[model samples]
Target: MAKEKSVYVCSNCGQESPKWIGKCPGCGEWNTYVEEIIRKESGPKKVSTGMESVKTRPITLNEIEAADEPRIDMYDEELNRVLGGGLVQGSLVLIGGEPGIGKSTLVLQTVLRIPEKRILYVSGEESARQLKLRADRLGSASGECLIVCETSLEQIYVHIKNTRPDLVIIDSIQTISTEILESSPGSVAQVRECSASILRFAKESHTPVILIGHINKEGSIAGPKVLEHIVDAVLQFEGDQHYMYRILRSIKNRFGSTAELGIYEMRQDGLRQVNNPSELLLSQDHEGMSGVAIASAIEALGLF
Candidate 1:
């Protein structure tokens, strides 16, 4: 048997309340609560997160082994630099940006260039034909990518098991839903649960997963605050639609430094990595201008 109940959840901090409140007691945010239905099963819950369960034990610091984290070369210099060399294995990365900011284009072109590794791209926002059209327009060399349009979390896992891809990418986390939750997709609960499940899968399978997410009107990722804390890295794609230049900034990274950034130029074919940003930033036309000035800056990678 199953029992259902309604509760108010804070969208900003994921605070729960039995009734609506003017302010969230958790994060002190005003009017951030939304009603959600929770379906509770009347039985002992089982842990099926794909991670192996080991007996609880403690080890001394001297007994623990330390090793370097393994990474996969993305082949894009700017991206590689921002990620502190390359994409780390078994890492769950979240890339958030405004609409039409080239988040999907960036991920698509990256995977298309990696032909040696099997990639699984699951998109819930765009259809297969639409993705294919975008891929063709990008004009990058094809790779071993398996595209599937799925929204159900259970079905996605089934595909993951059958395909066994080296890398997995979710086009947008807001659109995915699980059957256990009665709430609609994109709700705070759904995003938190889905991302947590993906994190477990990544750690257990040693496969990297990249999740694309939407931003709220407040210019933050459109989900509970806990969503950002669950992932290993959070990359922000920033640029004005009116400008040709885009910057990939690292907000949080457990495997590397967060001070690094990647620069790119959106072109007709695809995003062209700006290896030497100073070259484009200092132009011949601007040199003659009296008001224009040039200054050297330092990034985590090197001087620019």
Candidate 2:
């Protein structure tokens, strides 16, 4: 067994320090350092995953196949448009937003509409009963959606292997932890390690994983900067809690354009996709009003 020692690590950049400091030298953020336990082993320890062993080898550019990657339709036109038509296979997508901003509702409602695919919805923040209640309110529940309230990373992989789902969803990355690391869940080290492991699993098994993450005080994803770099795409769910309209903006997308956006309206029955903004943005009362001029402009893969 290896000996353990505690070290201060910055939550913003994953920088290590011998002791606590007021500001993070790596990211220049204040009060972002947290102590984490490290094992003094001879070399790095490998994370055990349920994915099949498929060794990768480098190949010449000419030998590689140049075919269009397959995509999974989310069934929501707004989400599909923002994801550059549809979600790509083997892609790891990270969705971040403020709490109570309808992140879970949007994902649950969308997945429920896809009855053909088998989806594994794992939640660490909410219980299975809570998710079921939300699903009941959302109304469709047509797909073969399995819900599990778990936080252990190893257990999650076990569930993945047993279920072999077509799509996997992690409610929030902050709450999931792995036994490989002694750091608590939501720590910088845990978030980085878990996300990297999930990304590897997604690629190796050719299964898409959607990770919902929390935002920090600065409004960025509550994890190290490398977390964003590990995923294939980063999407931001933005809107005020008091408002009915919400926006989904693509911050980074390796397979498609990042300028696209998705809009949804929050209602009592669930989230309703807004296919056309003209109907909501422009009202009959606004017609023939002074200082009102309608013009055509392209934004978020649509004409407005």
Candidate 3:
């Protein structure tokens, strides 16, 4: 067994310190340091030794196949458009947003929409009953979708192996923890490890994964900066809590372009995809207004 020591870590930048400090030297955030236990395992650690020798083959560019990657459509045109037609297989996607901004609802609705695929919906933040209630409210109950309220990373992987789901949905990455790490859930180390594990699973199994994550006070995903690099996609759920409108934008995408955007309207049933958001702005009442000059533009988006 190896000895463990306590170290202060900055929650913002994931910087380590020997002792607690008022501000983080890496990020300059005040009172962001928290003590975390780090263990030094008694084993020869692997470093960048040297590249292993292996048989390799080189193919010309003309010999490479040229075809579109497979995609799983969410059935919602707005969401599908934003995702560059649909979700790519073997991709790890991260969704982040502010609290009470309908991130969970959007994901749940999307999962429900795609009943053709078997998805394992893992939640650490909500009970099974609560999720069922939300699903009921959204009018989306799929026999193919399995819901599990779990927080252990290892257990989740075990379940994934047993179920062999076509897609996996993690409610929030910050709430899950691994057994090997002594640090608490949502810690910098735990978040980083869990995400890497999931990413590995996604790639190995050729299964797509969607991870819901909490945004920090800076409006970025809460975790190490490397977490974003590990995933195949990073999407943001942007919306004002006071309004019913929501926007989904891709910050990064490995399979598609990031210029697309998705718009949704929050209703009692669920999130309704707004295929043409400009239609809502045109009204009979607006036609008679003096200041309203109906300038012709493509798709009515020139109103800005």
Better of 1 and 3 by lDDT: 1
Per-residue lDDT tens digits for candidate 2, residues 165-194, read 999999999999999898889989899999
Query: By lDDT, highest first, what's the ranking?
Result: 1, 2, 3
Cα RMSD for candidates in order: 5.8, 6.0, 5.1
Which digits, one per residue and each the tens of the lDDT, describe model 3 over residues 1-304? Answer: 7989999877777788999999887878799888889887887877866577646677999999999989998878877777888898999999999988898999898888786788899999999999999999998779999999999999998899899899999989999999888998998889988999999888878999999998988899997776888999999999888789899999998888899999989899888888887776665567545876656453433565
Best by TM-score, which number? 1
N/CA/C clash count, model 1: 0
Worst 10 residues of 1 by lDDT: 280-289
Q: Per-residue lDDT of 203-280 in model 1, one digit per residue for the tens?
A: 988999999999998999999999999999999999989889999999998988899889999999889998888887
What lDDT is reached at residue 118 by model 1?
90
lDDT, residue 53, candidate 3: 68
lDDT computed for candidate 3: 0.88
